[model samples]
Target: MASESAANPPLAGKHILLGITGSIAAYKAAVLCRLLKTAGADVRVVMTPLAKQFITPLTMATLSKNPILVEFFDPENGAWNSHVSLGEWADCYLIAPATANTLAKMAGGIADNLLLTTYLSARCPVAVAPAMDLDMYAHEATQQNLRTLARRGVHIVEPGDGELASGLTGKGRMAEPDRIAAFVGDLLREKKKSLQGKRLIVTAGATIEAIDPVRFISNHSTGKMGYAIAGELAGRGAEVTLVTGRTSLPTPAGVERVDVLSAAEMYDAAVRAFDGADGAVMCAAVADYTPESVSETKIKKCDGDMCITLRRTRDIAAELGAHKGSRLLAGFALETHDEEAHAEAKLAKKNFDFIVLNSLRDAGAGFRGDTNKVTFIDRAGREELPLMPKREVAARIADKIEKILK
Candidate 1:
């Protein structure tokens, strides 16, 4: 048993605060607690009053080997369960089987229960695994609440798509116990301050070049990839500045955001920020060209074809590379044909330390998607990667940067 614990010590000696909410999925918390214990974590269970109806506290206590906490104080002994103390004691606070009501309350800052109160007081990282009916999960209000939490740096373990308690087939099932445990372990295992004191600049999204007040030119860049990179760098303790174009995505936690509308604006922002940055990731899909002149008003509909003169926009990555001086600069290339050749050319022309290449012809490897397939090109050669979540790709990028820094 000792050797087994030593063999998988990613979460060993860590304090975990497990909050179970009111949902039929609460029964799964028992298995989760056991798995966490087997992984060598010190597990403490906090349950909502309603959660007791779904699963008994005794079962949880037996698995976790700790007393279950349901109320603010123990009535039998009159011992107070200090939410602040619990919050301070944990390394990570995980809420599983989070119902719509609990999620809404959490979003609204209503801390009527011990678990919610602990959440409000927790200085540790927070995560949630939502469990509810498909309809409730799909509701806009719930999604907005989830987004709000995500913006605040709460890790959301996305629910799986499968049969629900209401006999509906869709999302909103809490992730399985083993998967949840692995996720939490991964979070705890990450080096929290690997790039401390370093500063990085990242540009993201589609730059809009206006031809008229009502008409503009832009690509399909949604900024997901750039945002993920920024978040990853921030997680590694680098002070990140995100120069972003128009997109509704929330700013990553711990990142400074500079909003811009056009390619020229993004160029100015990225250049200014890069002057103080230790490195930069050129992830924005900046426009290659923009209109030479702007129309003051919306162009009236005409029967004849219209033409607008365009000129090349300033190259942000090239300018940064010209002044790179020992500073690291990474660039991205999205191509349709001769992908490797184009990427290689850009790698040399931009003076990038390395380049990330993704081809449009490859499915699930382009803009406006959560997943990407990429290859890393450098003077040392290439490293091909499989299709993965953008967040994972960001981690790989961050890893490379760390190695370079080392």
Candidate 2:
């Protein structure tokens, strides 16, 4: 029987195929192998021919508790190391110390060795941790190759910036063993389709209200929270529609994005998406007012102070709430004073199933930041959450959505 500690690990019972490539960082593969094993994964090692020179097969074999594979067949016995079988058995394929040469080959679909062949055959998710000299890592070709792999759904553990084997310092160092192991564990955990068959709408970023052709009023919201929620929903198999304002964030995987610039535009898109959605997360920082009369051209710089008229924009959440019927609706409140009161008011006013409340006075709790301290408020009561990463907050929100859906 497996030990309690071993069985309780995040990677427990998972089969991991670790690929090593030719690089000075190949020596770190031994440590990575050990970490994966310690996390209760059944690890098997595959190495390129040149990788053997940097890290001995015996070292990897001892750590993995399995023979390292380097060729298609054993020279002495003619026994085959079947790539197909390896591919089928693994829950994840991790290529650590993935050299620039190997990355290019992977990008080009070159299967010249056992490791590459296994990668081509693998049915599981593939993750790569790149390692190379600073210049090589910065080269446009390498960047393009990495982008290609990313577009094909390969998980990339971005290289760290530090001293390289070439006696120079810059980005291209492979991530540490512990970090790599944790990333693999996370990748596997995210594969669970907990939200399958559900459709969701997420509104994100700060809506722009134009005052002139070049000048617009917006907020500090970067759409990080909303984007994270959308990503989390999509990861759990929810069909997500992201209704977003101006932000540079890429669309999350498996999400349909509808771009909008103004509060009016967002209101239109959100309503349309919400009609077919199982739930809606109203996370955008929308402008409450717009210029009553927008100037067609840029306003001239005048010595005298100018006054512009303002009008209230349409309330997207309230409109959706009125017509929600059986659909779930979640709203966010960013407050500075009387946080709980404001949140409860919004929760009641918008008829939200629950409202996520964050105080701007609390450090790292709102807008343009990566962390948040929030409270989930409903008619029953409030559940306060500690300060945490925005992604984790998104997960908690997703958990609530899942329960309401069920």
Please, what is the TM-score per model? 0.84, 0.75
Cα-based lDDT for every prediction: 0.92, 0.90
Best-fitting candidate, scored by TM-score:
1
- Candidate 2, superposed: residue stretches over 4 Å from native: 1-5, 19-31, 45-62, 65-89, 95-121, 128-151, 156-180, 189-194, 211-213, 293-302, 306-308
Instruction: Point out where model 1 deviates above 4 Å.
Output: 1-8, 23-28, 52-59, 74-79, 130-153, 158-176, 190-192, 211-215, 291-310
Clashing pairs in 1: none
In angstroms, the error of model 2 at 41 is 1.7
Q: Write the per-residue lDDT of candidate 1 for residues 37-113, one digit (tens) a residue.
A: 98889999999999999999999999999999999999989999999999999999999988999989989999999
Any residue pairs clashing in model 2, and if so which?
A: none
Tens digit of lDDT per residue, candidate 2, span 1-406?
1223553877788999999999999988988888888788999999999998899999999999999999999999999999999999999999998999999999999999999999999999999999999999988889888867865778887677788899999889998887788778778873679899999999999999999999999999999899889988988999999999987665666788899999999999999888777989999999999999899989999898999899999999999999999999999999999999989989999989999999999997898766899999998898999999787899999999989899
